[model samples]
Target chain A: MYEQLDQSIQQLMWDVRKRTLKRMQSAYDVAMKTSYKDLVTTVDKENERFIDDHLRKLDPNAKIVSEEGLGDKVTDLKGPVFIVDPIDGTMNFVMQHRNFAIMIAFFVDGQPVYGYIMDVIEGTLYHGGPGKGVYCNDQRLHAPADNDLHDSLVVLNSGITLNGGHNFREIGLQARGVRMYGSAGIEMIAVITGRVGGYLSYLHPWDLAAGMAMAKELGLSVKAIDEKELDVLSSNLVLVATQQVSRDISELIN
Target chain B: MYEQLDQSIQQLMWDVRKRTLKRMQSAYDVAMKTSYKDLVTTVDKENERFIDDHLRKLDPNAKIVSEEGLGDKVTDLKGPVFIVDPIDGTMNFVMQHRNFAIMIAFFVDGQPVYGYIMDVIEGTLYHGGPGKGVYCNDQRLHAPADNDLHDSLVVLNSGITLNGGHNFREIGLQARGVRMYGSAGIEMIAVITGRVGGYLSYLHPWDLAAGMAMAKELGLSVKAIDEKELDVLSSNLVLVATQQVSRDISELIN
Candidate 1:
């Protein structure tokens, strides 16, 4: 039922990728947010504006929620909403010149309907939601086999791992190893592809929305560590992984 | 004087890349070493043998030291010594199927003469030593600006960071951010390219040899964290970074 919408969103994401990649090649301006570690750039603002314009034109009544303040002031996802993080991992983009992504999710009546996460430099897109199977580009992705937490490789955020919050250090010890790529979209995609068994991080709405939307469809479980359903408008300590691994992490963290 | 030898090693590395990339596409055998977190594969051994054979043929009198147990046992870095980690980041190779590298170093009279670290999947090679400047693929890499420890992004090993050894936790807290890519070769390349300012971890002779050689050519300091000269034949806690940042890390850790 949402095929056309998914395709349209996917096409728009590619266009965003093209524009973002071009901007990455040239020099750009950067501004700090919250702390020195948190970053935003001119490319981020420009990409948000571009996606917002395209999404508004695609569905005039849809509410757009984005990172760079170019979208509607979104309080709740009660109606059609496009949640966007125009440049996820801006720190990576500004510093590493790679490993960043563009993310978007379309929700209707507070239900995730379509999601997209594009690793811009690598040109790989992880997209889908609900009945549509998840995909990395043209290839369909199956639900990953449920590996136990002890047997899995995990992507961890640097702060949480060091802080020892949520018993994360114990979890790190049990896991095969931990990788830190500093991009939520790429980390989620790693789980979807079975490259890593799980990923855990604290994230804002735009950062978590799109990846989580697709994560669920791939037969992975994504949730707030507090055991409540994720609230679309609020930040959450999120974990996405195979069902068994997610359960294992929840037990440890909780 | 080493131009011919350097060119030959570079050509051999490309050949290794081709063989390894093709093998990565197919199934291969993996064996655990020390622990499940440590892995070795048939492909690793095969690549090592391949490189060893070529190196022997290129300079028949040179003594070879390799990770895969295919090279001679040498007590010291006397005469012509070739150190090879045919596949650094073997865990990455087995788990992520990427981020692994082919690292090689050539030393004569215990002096580093040439070094090569090939990020096989990305097809970017970081190679050179001493009088020759470092190059990432074809582009010459200049010495990275001596950013302070607080101003830099650092790549750290997951085990060491969480273990809180070498004052690593303090370093992580102080840096702009910390990253863990699981490949020392790629991490060192990140330093040479200025994508990251420093990398530190415990490493074996094969793992440390190549990258340290290239690092010195880029005007980066590579040293034993204990403020002693490295024992080339034994594992050492190592740090590779810009001069000032290395000193800063040294002071903090010491």
Candidate 2:
């Protein structure tokens, strides 16, 4: 039954990816008129609507949470719940057009059962179920080799790092290097693929839900500030890292 | 004659973009035996060779300066020389396969005469010749509005921000926000397109050559640290910003 549900959700995600891509090509230019900081294009709204409608049809009983306000309101994340970010990295979607992604995760009783992150331009999906290992397209991904902080490149938010938010600078100083690729979904893909040992950012639930699902499946540590289990309903400073690297980073930052 | 020269260089740049794209797709999955920090993939060398060979045919007498050592020895910036970075943001190219770009610039008597930055996957080229308006794929771009620090977004390397390089914290505090996009070439494009007010990063010459040309032509300020004119062949903390935002950030950082 879980396998059947996973297959259906994957199909839904692919459809979402296609519809989002078409809308983005036409709507990106319109964002130029809006204030750059507050730039949200017509595509963002349309994509979220498209995804939400399809998701409701697929799982009528599930509560939906999303960034673009297309999903239902729910006080608690119990039973089957779907978290969707129709377009993660709206700035990149409106401005750069390539770094943005479509992210969706299915959680059961506060635990992610499935996650999907699609790089729309490349048509590549990084996805997996809890017991089924991660896959980048058709190829299965092995768990990343254990890596240490001094030997690891990390992804961090420049704003947070500069503001000394969540002790970001101490973590930055201990790592081999730091990279910031804007989109939380894409950065999470990097972490799952082992391109970066960890990713640290203050992000919304829709921004993290899908990627967090994949990270946990790939044997990486996923935690909120103070090293607690992630609260999937609010903004949190999330850390996704290898066990050793997470330990080193947490020690520095904490 | 200048028109013909510009067309020739643009054609060469397109070819480089195509070849690099193909090479990158095929080579990204190879395992690294060396340290990740020092890992230079086969594609980098091959892409540099392809670019160097084509540029040499276009300007046989011109010295070629390149990042990957596959070009002519360019100890002195003399005569009409071509500066090329076959793949800027090589780590992104290797790890993410999306954020990187191909950069090229022509310096005549050490003054930029032409520049090209190609988004390899998107096939969009930002190019211009001296006195010829800057363009992204045939559409002319207007100079960004004169923005102040409090109303502007600045792009800086996350590493630099964390280490307090150039007082990035102070600069971040003054600006509307700070973003780290991980690619100097891409960050320059952000500034050119008005998505970002400025980009500050410690950059090598190849990284900044093409970007500086575009920024300067579009009425943006491109300066070295301490408000000095940038020497074309040296590494420095380069600042590319709109005129007013540059002054505001410089005051904050200094």
Candidate 3:
């Protein structure tokens, strides 16, 4: 039902990647929205404007949900909802100028239709949805092996293992090794591409929307921490993992 | 005195990157050396052999110290010494097939003459040493700005912050963020590129040698924790950072 739209959005993402990278090279200002951890940049806003405008041109009727407040309030996913995260790893963007991503996911009545995660620096776009099979650029990406925690590495952020009361430390020890790259979109790429077994972090709707869509298409699982129903309109303590690793995480936690 | 030698080694590193990445695409056997965390693959042995032979041809009198035990067992760095970490993130290699590196460093009479770190997946060769400027893929890489903990991100492993008592958690909270990518070579690349402020980990001679060489050239500090003098023959708890941030780490620890 969405093949033509998928090709259009993928082309749009390539255009977004090129223009955003050019802006990064030319000039951009960095500023903190809440704290040093939460950063926003002029490039981010400009990119959001660029993407939102293009998305509007593509699907003007879609209700948009964006990270930088350039789109709609998006109270409900009642219709075609467009979720945009212009630069997903804002701190990495502000600090390292790499490891960030441009993400946009299209949903219809809360069901993900076509999701896009463009690794801006590498120029590899991970895009697809239900019935579409995932693609890392032009190649057909394979689903990860159904390996459990013992044989696979996991992606983590320190807050879950250090600040919160979770068994992430134990999980890290059991799961071959632990890797922490501070980008939700990039880390999700890790999971979607089968590079890591799973990823656990507190992620916003915009941050996980595209990743969740791609992961699901690749036969992986995405869920909230407590196994509660995930609310697409709100922040979620998210876990995206291979099916076996998902059970392994629960087994260890329990 | 060694301009010609530098270009030659850099070219050799680029070749090593190509061969290693090609080997990764083919069949390889993964085995546990000490634990699941310490992995060695057939490709690691092959890459070491490839690099050792090239180094021998480049400088016949040099001694080699290799990770997979494919090189010499010399006691001290009395003459030209070539250190090789065939696959520096073997776990990442065995699992993810990326985030690994092929590292080789040349030292003359215990002084770093040249260093090479090739990020195999990305195909970026970061190489240089004393009297030579660092280059990231032919671009003159600039030394990172001297920034303190609060304004910068830090790299860490779980053992330090979660298992050992090093004030790393407090230090992480104070810093911009803490990143842990699991590969010593890749993490060191992050430090050399100024992507992150510092990296702290327990490192072996082969793991630290190439990074130590290039890092020193870029004006970053490489030190043993507790201000102990590092022994090139043994493993040490290493810290690589900007000078002021090195002081900041000491302050937080004390």
Candidate 4:
């Protein structure tokens, strides 16, 4: 019975995400007529409102923390909360029309229970509930084998190295190679799919919530600074990696 | 009659590229069985030989300059020449299946007369001939409206700020934003489609050949350092952009 309910919710969320993507695409096509760098279009705001409304109707008791500032201001993660990032990679969506993802995470008393990351253009969904295993589209994902730092690839902001921001230069030297794809949601997908061993970046709650759920389900580590569980309300440098690689990288960075 | 011949050659080249993609995919899938980065397959030589053999029958007088060195070595581009990169973005192809492209260019008397950049995963082709308009799949591209640096989005390797390999740090500061997608072919697509105002990177001739052709046809400037036509045999920092944006960026970098 619980499985049926979860599937039903998944289907509803999937439909909502697809509709939101279409609307965003149309708005983006129109916005191309003007300057591309201007942030927060009407479509972005409208889409967030639509999702928030639908989620509210579905779970009236759920507290929402969203990027667009339409949700409650709860200081603590005390109850059922839906963390939403209406558009995780706004710049990528506004400019490239690819590499952007819609991220949503459901947390119970500050612990994640379910997560979903959708690649809009490719129509791929990465989602899983606690202990239910992760899925990319319809297929199940097995945990990627344990790998070391030298044999692993990473996703990071290249500007970190250039600007001497947050010890990124040292991190770059430790990894075999680094890739910058410019979208947090897409970067999370790479980590879950084992294309890259880990992803580290400074991100907001909406950006990290769904990805944290998916990463945890894949047997990958999802932690805040110093290997602690993430604080859902504040921005921090997060790292998601295999246990061994995470240990190696954490020791180096910390 | 000439049009039919051109179409036939295009079809043959496209088929060859598709096969090459499949071979690489198989190698990657098998490698994933043991480890992700442990296998670096040597299909580059075989793929180049296969493509060169096929092109020879269609254009017997065409000189071939391929990455794997399977073709003739001509000192001067005196006649028809086929520039080929059997596997562009080899690292991405070896590590991740989604971000690579196959590039081919046809030059006549030392000038790019035709070119194709195929995104193998998505199966989209950006192709054009001299005197013909550029295309993505079958849709024609209009030259994007002129954009200024402050209003423009640019793509560059994120490491530019850290490695100081090229003058990327200064350019990154000047643009509205910077994106790094990890493949020269895909990055070129961002510019051709007007999602980005420009792309700058140190690239080899085979890597830039097809992209240069498509960029030029789309009314974007394709220039080597010092603002000269690119020599088709050397590695250099190449820039592709709208004429106005390119000029603005050149001044900033200089």
Candidate 5:
């Protein structure tokens, strides 16, 4: 179950979260990471450093793979590993000053053990993994009720949907509604909490790492858009949703 | 400019808002007003009644047209008229319990004078019209920067998008992103606050009445999809956006 490990991770996450909130209150520099569409701020780098130091202290033997390049060269997940995104929605943070999140995933021998997705402004921590089950803050969250695509609200990525990438527009039409909150972590948390039925995006390892872990525990399916399984080491066009929703979406899109 | 009327209406709105918040805290009844898609709650009825009574008290001669059948039945906007949607985004209120708003528009001799759209939960009020510049809460809102169709977020109605109404799929693809917040008032507010570039929906008079007033003050263009001027008394495929965005979207779709 890794209950003990979950508890430990939760504690570490809260500490990191508090640090992040404090940093956000102060002015920080911003820079483009890939394009103007992709951004990083001083807060992201500082938070990454803070989390990296803490993780190193928490489990010296564990390898850390993080978004900010402050961790090890993580080519394989053979040993205990922590995948981290210091600030998951940097664009939202830079623009809306809300909807951003901090994420961390704990894995052992290539299997997810625990995950945490913390909404920085809302002060929510969605954390857990398979066997232990998922949770939002202190409340134990039940898996979302199964609903057909036509009866559920789903989250979609803006660029992907607009570009017709992965047939997102067709899938979006089937859902009761579509929300674009601009944060993968926040969107996945919505799926786990049943606020939305699913979230689809082309995401990097760090973007989906924590969310995928928690979602799996909630009996939600997390997989590649194509008929392939996901590997933690790479990026994929991912779908996180209830089993029926995943099946419905794939059947329509594929 | 109706400066004195704006002040008086603002006071009345705050009172109604306070009452609505208190009522929301207590248990309330819900019933379908039309189909399963349309809903009315004790809260909606109560809020409508409260606003209607207050508006009557404010101006006995003014004709009030409201969504919940609590106001006057006037055919034309010949005198001082108030067009109100006591609770815009009723479905959102019924399901998500948030993202809904209270909307009101004041007209004098068939010309829009002042408007208000208040997000109850966030406690932010967006109000203004015509010669009066729009304001979000206490701060004045400048007109959003002009962007092309491919550079801005647009909000759409789920039913319309899914049904392929008004070439929604093609229009959605042209925008930088699409968001569905389930509330017309909130979506319009997003446009006013520069959170999104535009919002298009097939809306009744009560849905667009309030937003249309304030949007015009911010130099945004509100029009029908068929290149016709909005009647504001009839349902139409409405487009609300900056001048450039509106032109780009219309050119691409029409």
Candidate 6:
């Protein structure tokens, strides 16, 4: 564990979180990044800038990969790198003003060192790493029971499930129940907290980075849906689940 | 308006909310009511008893129709009635210990007087009716902009949507996005808060009553998917949404 780096990162997150709450109480300008579903708010940009400045100071040599284009192009994670999503669920941020999260992951020489997924509204910080163990605030979390696919709830991207992407509709049926919370960070919170058996979504690097680290640290299966290696800088259809559930999903889809 | 009833109910809800939070801090027994999808926990039972006893003292003359069988089995809403769901999302309550709610609705001569839908974890209480107007805690709510179905998100029952029940899949596809949160109370929270344009689910009386009351008061459409008048005492495919969204869903389904 990078003890000093971890502490610095956690402190930065809490500081950023306070500003985010105050910033959210007022209005912010919003613009579509790609589609109406893809939004970028002034708050998102401000938060990214705030975090980027702090991250730069925390690890001067580390390259920062960020969603809002304020950081490096980050073609690879060959060295110390920080991947950040200032607001992981912008649509939910625009519509509900809740369920959005700030996610950050740190990697050293291509190995995850630590990750943070903060539920902004609830002020809950889920942070830790493989050797350090995962935590919800000060509470250490055990690896959730690996329940069978048919016996546990799953979180699916609603669009994919409705459109039958990767036979997600069938996968939804196989689970004990299905939920769609819109925010990947919130969905990942469900997964890491053992609220759901797993999550399946097509996500960008910034969206998947923090969640993937936490899932991996928790000893959950974190993999590409297509059974290929996940390029740390590229988007993919990802599955973060228990071993048994992951196998069930892969078999059903393939 | 039963002004006295309204004040008493709100106070009772706050009291119950405190007790519920305290009760949840300890472990509770969980049992399946019918299937794995259906769960009843000791918290549900204890919460129901607490609320029932309070309701009995608050409105000695009114009938209580509740989910846990702590209520009357009257066939119709013929007089002053209090419809309650001690815990609206028992499955969510069991699995996540959050995203559940305590819901209650009051009707006199089959006309809604007021309703309460409290998001248990968030401690947000949405309570109001037609003449009194709706309030989320101390802030009064205006009718949310009735955006077109294609522009607004729709919340669906994951099971029903995947199974194409009531042509919900098609309806889901037509919306900008779809989300499923599992609990009727939580889903209703999305609707009444104007976070989503609409919500559709197969619901029991207790599940639908409080949400329906709040939605109606907010000037949204609260109706049966079949375009039939709701019975207020029977299970049905319920649609609670902005007027435009409701019409769009009905058109898409038909």
Give the best candidate by TM-score.
1
Q: What TM-score would each prediction reach against the true structure?
A: 0.97, 0.84, 0.97, 0.91, 0.85, 0.95
Error of 1 at B134 (Å): 1.6
Give a tens-digit lDDT track for model 4, residues B1-254.
23554565578667866787667655433233234422334665666778788889878988998876788886777888888877666667765667777778888888877787888788888888667778888899888767877767787754444576557777776776777666788888888889889888878778888888778777888888567767877777788888888888888774
DockQ, ranked from best to worst: 1, 6, 3, 4, 2, 5
Candidate 5 segments exceeding 4 Å error = A1-36, A131-135, A163-170, A225-227, B1-8, B11-38, B147-151, B159-175
Which residue pairs show collisions in model 6? none
Per-residue CA lDDT of model 2 for B1-254, tens digit only, reads 46887898788878888777666556344334344543456776777888888888887888899887877777777798888887776666765566778888998888888889988877889998557889998899888888887777778776678777778788876776667666778888889988888888888889888887788888998899677768878898888899998898878775
Q: What are the clashing pairs of model 3?
A: none
Using lDDT as the measure, what is the rank order of every candidate, best first? 1, 6, 3, 5, 2, 4
State fnat for each of the candidate structures: 0.66, 0.45, 0.66, 0.43, 0.31, 0.78
- Per-residue lDDT for B107-207 in model 1, tens only? 98888988999999989888999998888888888788899888788998789777777788888888888888888888878888878888988999998
TM-score of predicted chain A against the true chain A, for each candidate:
0.97, 0.93, 0.97, 0.90, 0.96, 0.98
Predicted complex 6: CAPRI docking category: medium
When summed lDDT is taken over every stretch of 10 residues in candidate 2 chain B, the lowest stretch is: B27-36
Interface RMSD (Å) of candidate 2: 3.3
Clashing pairs in 1: none
DockQ of each: 0.75, 0.36, 0.73, 0.43, 0.36, 0.75
Task: Report the candidate with higher lDDT, 4 versus 6.
Answer: 6
- What lDDT does each candidate get? 0.88, 0.80, 0.86, 0.75, 0.83, 0.87
lDDT of 4 at A59: 82
> On a 0 to 100 scale, what is the lDDT of residue A180 in model 6?
88
Preferred candidate (DockQ higher): 3 or 5: 3
Q: Candidate 3's residue-wise lDDT over A1-254, tens digit each?
A: 77777888899899989998888877778898988778898888998999899889888899899999999988899989899999998888888888999999999999988889999988899998888888988898988998898888888777767663577778888888888888888999999999999998889988899988888888898998789998878998888999999998977762
* Global Cα lDDT for candidate 1: 0.88
True-vs-predicted CA distance for residue B164, candidate 6, Å: 1.4
Residue B214 local lDDT, model 2:
81
